[model samples]
Target chain A: MTDLRKSDRLIKLGLLMIAFSAISALFVITLFIFEQGGPIMFKYGLKSFIFGQDWYPSEKIFGLWPMIVGSLMVTLGALIIGVPLGLATAIFLAEFSSRRLARILKPVIELLAGIPSVVYGFLGLMFLIPFIRENLGGPGLSVLAASIILGIMILPTVISISLDSIRAVPDCYREGSIALGATRWQTVRMVVLPAARSGILAAIILGMGRAIGETMAVIMVAGNAAEIPSSILQPVRTLTSNIALEMGYAAGEHRQALFATGVILFVIIMVLNTIANLTASRQGKR
Target chain B: MKETAIEVRNLNHFYNRHQSLKNINLEVYRHEILAIIGPAKSGKSTFLTCLNRMSDLIPGARVEGQILIDGQDIYRPEVDVVALRRKFGMVFATPIPLPMSIYENVVYGVRLAGKNNRPELDRLVEDSLEKAGLWNEVKDRLRISALKLSGGQQQRLCLARILALKPEYILLDEPTSGLDPISTMKIEDSLRRLKQNYTIILVTNNTKQAARVADRTAFFLMGELVEVAETEIIFTRPTDKRTEAYLEGKFG
Candidate 1:
């Protein structure tokens, strides 16, 4: 009995230590980032850093308006293109497609997600950029190219999350709707989609975050211009790619400004994550 | 001499290669409660689902049967399955109200069928809730989510959803199995009143419930219909020894 009690105490202590260590690691990372970036942000004033669009290292002037706008435009474009296709694919997989077709398609979608973002960027650069340049009459790298590539990259996430949500609905719900004289598509649109609304929203928000934070792919195709473009065909610079491209060479005040951009990007991602978490909980409650 | 509401002829069903229901024949009279009683997996639920074509919803399920609703063959290729289902609604064992407000849950079927006028929807919601015996309790809280209701109220709300469709026939698969005694009694009372206008086919393992509410009772064993007779006869002096043994608690 004494031996068992000793072992139990030891296990409890081990678990406590593990939990404390995990939490402390997270706290340490957060503190380190805040300690490095907070003073610079306060000195510059958060509003000017956010609203000022001019980002010139030589003149020591940095603003994020263009970067923020570029991120929004690209993410919105991706959502516009990806959401309907993802929803359609999810509905087909969940409701209409035969088992064999679903079996074949689901793995293909997973594979699409598994392909490295760099590979996608390379593919976009080689084929899609040239196609746009030849056909649409613009430079190879543009916001349109970045948006198209990001949309494809995020398609798998949207389809997978929406499919899981739709599948999570009870079989009885479908039967109930069908028993009410709803055709297959009608049941999907009226019953299944509404029931999976929060989950679908969560999926879209996650995709939006991915589109906004994506760096390497956007860097390869977005042309890295620090100006808000008038059309999709023009070049732009997202906050993530701007930070990645200049962070290594930047020093002193310039580096602090780059870290400030990192801080802003971090805030945006945090907000997106909070929204995703809220919707996820709402789905659970439903 | 009563007008038949449903006619089942040479019905057989199989789950994959396993036969779950054998050749069966029966007729359900209009405005009467017909109860199906059986041991677990004796194909009672299967038979009830076949009446409304719900048995075929699952993949790898096959049915060899002819079910006629009002002299029209439901199994015929030209018949619209959706329309057939709309005319014959179902209630499952567990309460499954849609994830919406109480009023929306009640009128979901109507809206699905394209009735969107607010006053018409309100009337149907009130009438269905009243018929299901839930209006008095939920009328004030109609805007609240349906899932917030008690288990019994959720079951009744499901009933109201079906009732809103104004189906000629209602198939209930153990509608009261999950309810407390009082809620069970409420459901039974609602069914009693509902049978004045709609035919009801109920499947249950609760023989006492069958005796209490069913006008007629059918006993099933090993996917076969053992006997069907008036509820009193089936309980008090059944012709089939299997039913007698079951009712006597000898062995299932």
Candidate 2:
């Protein structure tokens, strides 16, 4: 018994160390980004660094307002396109589909997440761009292209998590509603959706995080024009695209500015993640 | 002669190939409490669900029976199941309160039926809660989450939800099994009063509960109803030996 206990303690300690390593790595990376990014912000003045609408690294002018606006517009556009489609698909799978159909379709929907992000970007470049240029009168590579690609990319995250939360609702809630003469659609709209609201919100928040953090795909399709786009047809550069496009040639304060972009992205993701956690925890308590 | 609220003839139920109920024949009178007492796997709950066609929700669950509600054949292929369900509101053993405020929980059924008038909704909520004996406790806290209520209060809230529908028949499946004694007594008291307005079908594992609130009692075993008689007669001088043995705690 003592030998078993001793081995258990050793295993516990090893697992604890592994867990702490992941957390410590996060702390170190965040500290390093802030340490590298903080001086540049102070030198340029925080307001000017964030709000100035110009970007000329060679001229030592780094205003990230355009990129920030670009990121917000792209993320917002993705959500507008993704949320309704994802939620509807999730509802169909969780509530309406027969078991055999759900079995086949759910896995196929989840498989979308496994396909590489670059492949989606490539597909957008190949087909969506030309189609948009011909039909919508745009330069092919624009905020519209980026939004469509990111929306497709985030569908798996939204659909799977929303489906899971919808399924997690107890059958009794449905039974009670049905027993009271509610149709299937009525029951889902009233009881099941309300019961799963927090979880669905959390799923959407996580999907938002995914859309904003996506780099390779957005960089490929967003056209990387370092100016604030006035319309969906115009080209724009997100904070992520700004970093990925310029990091290879960047040195000195320009490199620090890239790290500063990382800092902003990290903070946004952390806030979204925190909100998701709160929603999930509240659901658990209920 | 008492009016028949519901009549079942040669009722048979199956889940895939396995039969859950066999040749169930019974009649529930209007404004009467009929207690169904049975051990586990006795098809009591299945019998109740079949009345409202709640079994339709379960995959591979099939029913072959003549269930007449108000002289209409409920099992007919063209019957609107939603309307049939509204006629017989059900309450399960476990209390399932919707994730909403107490007032909202009671009006959920009414709202689904597309009655959205505010004054009518307020009246219905108050009337239903009063009938369920839950009004005094929750009247002042109508906006609070129903989940914040005690287990017993939650169960009453479920009862209020059904009451808001104004169902002709109320089907209860071991509603008091999870409740404490005081809560059970409160439910029993409300059930006795409710029989004045609606017919009730109660399935219970506790014989004492059956004796307390039942006007008539039916005994079932292994998907078969052994005997059904007046509540007092069934308890004291049962006709069937199986019923006698079950009452004496000989075997389930």
Please report the candidate that would top lDDT against the real structure.
2
Residues A50-147, model 1: lDDT tens digits: 89878787687777889989988898888888888888899899898998999999989989988888998999989999999999977868889999
Identify the CAPRI category of the predicted complex in candidate 1.
Answer: medium
Best by DockQ: 2
Please report, in order, the local distance difference test score of every candidate based on alpha carbons: 0.88, 0.91
- Among the candidates, what TM-score does chain A have in each? 0.92, 0.95
Off by over 4 Å in 2: A1-12, A274-286
- The DockQ assigned to candidate 2 is 0.72
Query: What does candidate 1's lDDT look like per residue over B5-64, in tens digits?
Result: 888888999999999999898989999999999899999998987877877688889999
Best by TM-score: 2
lDDT of 2 by residue, A158-206 (tens): 9999999999999998898889889999999999998898879977897
Error of 2 at B14 (Å): 0.9
Compared with the true structure, the alpha-carbon lDDT of candidate 2 equals 0.91
